[model samples]
Target: MAEQVTLYTNPMSRGRIVRWMLEEIGQPYKTEWLAYGPQMKSADFTAINPLGKVPAIRHGATVVTETPAILAYLADAFPQAGLAPAPADRGNYYRWLFFTSGPVESAVISQACGFTVPDDRRPMVGFVDMQRMMDIIASAITANPYVAGDAFSAADIYIASHLSFSTRVGSVGSRPVFADYIARMTDRDAFRRASAIDDEARAAQASKG
Candidate 1:
């Protein structure tokens, strides 16, 4: 049976990541593209995700929000996708997952929005600084073909999304390491199919106005 998954997302948002996950899932799914401002903040949408964020998915009765959570859920929910590493290799699997999802995300978004802590209070920031955090990510990917040692996992999806966005926003340098890793990840057939759909959707939405 086809999976009954409803993806509620904004065409131009992090929803692309969930779309990629859906493509990787290789199951029939529906998408309810949402508009920003009032539409996203509407009561119905808020009931799905209190924060009114895109990339939220409704799988059966389970609703998952946040990019990392959604991706991880899909990986587990669709074991045939081969999105998770073996049990033994999961040590680094989860380590980088939380790291990229938490501190690294804060660092990148905060810097992009001009939100920063003072020098004295910088220590309170888990990532400390964007450059340092990115350097850590770069070194890790440079050493391994994938984030969690050898296997390709949902962890790669989260980290790769961050790296791609970080480069666009100038949060991280466009070093060869970052570019090479992204190239490797994005080249996957699943990613290509998902991104093509998102790109078309975004273009169509833009042309409407």
Candidate 2:
């Protein structure tokens, strides 16, 4: 029998990304929703994630955290879903996936928090400028139908999610390329399903508050 897969998440957190990926994989899994604050920082949840962050998953004995890592793990674990490209065709896959997870997100979040890298220190930073980062992203996405290749992959999920949030929060400029890519990547049943689940959960939380 396949080991049960369980997700520890809050609907309002980055767990939404994992939810979308799970929907894409079409797997039967359990979701353990934890409210923010004490619930997340409690002893039990901390055992699963010392950092007490949402979007962590346990596939039997295997525990995975971080949105990008979770997406990558799910894609590899369920190869039949085809969320990962062929190993030979994975150059762009690994590239954009890590890029978005690391430099892109770091830059976006840093800027959003009103922290800017000094111009002289740009050389030391992993990402130089927001416009430059956006341009690079635009070029990569335009080069292929998807970030990894002609077919959709886990990279798209992470990249699209990042861009969607960043653009919405004014961290990244709105561009036709980004808008089109996000629409194309998310114009699927999985994305819609994930959105609906999170939306409902978020609404319920608001009602309770």
Candidate 3:
């Protein structure tokens, strides 16, 4: 029998990324929507995640937390969905995927918060400046149709969401490549559906006040 999958998430958090991944994989999983504030820090939720973060999942007896782990696990578990690169492409697949989640995210957050490493220690930070990170990401898309090469794998889901979020937060400049990439990802049926649901959830929450 297939395992029962339960997703614990709050729409306002990084859970949105998990939501997008779920939609991309076309899976039927249960969602336990969590309210923010004290509820997230409750003992029950803390048992699932000691850090009290959103976007945790339970697949049968297996409990997975962290956004990147969830993405990678979903792709591997649902091979028919074609969410991952083939074994031969695993090197590059893992490379860019971690790059986006780690360095790219770190650099963008730093820049958005107006924090900077010591001028002499910049090279040790593992990411070029934000503009350079944006340029490298943009150039990657321009050079290849998707983040992990030609195939539209889960890497694109991660990368696309990062680009979209960065653009919205003004961390990424409005370069042509960035704009086009956002348009491409947003046009996807799965993304549209996920976005509509998110919008509806937000609107409904606002209506209660």
When summed lDDT is taken over every stretch of 10 residues in candidate 2, the lowest stretch is 1-10
lDDT, ranked from best to worst: 2, 1, 3
Best by lDDT: 2
Q: Rate the local accuracy (lDDT) of all candidates.
A: 0.85, 0.92, 0.82
> Which wins on lDDT, candidate 2 or candidate 3?
2
Candidate 1 lDDT by residue in tens digits, 122-199: 777687777788788888787788998877888888788878977877777788888889889888898999888889
Score candidate 2 by lDDT: 0.92
Model 1: which residue pairs collide? none
TM-score of 1: 0.94
Query: Which regions in candidate 2 have their CA more than 4 angstroms from the true location?
Result: none
Error of 2 at 160 (Å): 0.8
Q: Which residues of candidate 1, in runs, are more than 4 Å off?
A: none
Query: How far is 192's C-alpha from truth in model 1 (Å)?
Result: 1.2
Name the candidate, 1 or 3, with the larger TM-score value.
Answer: 1
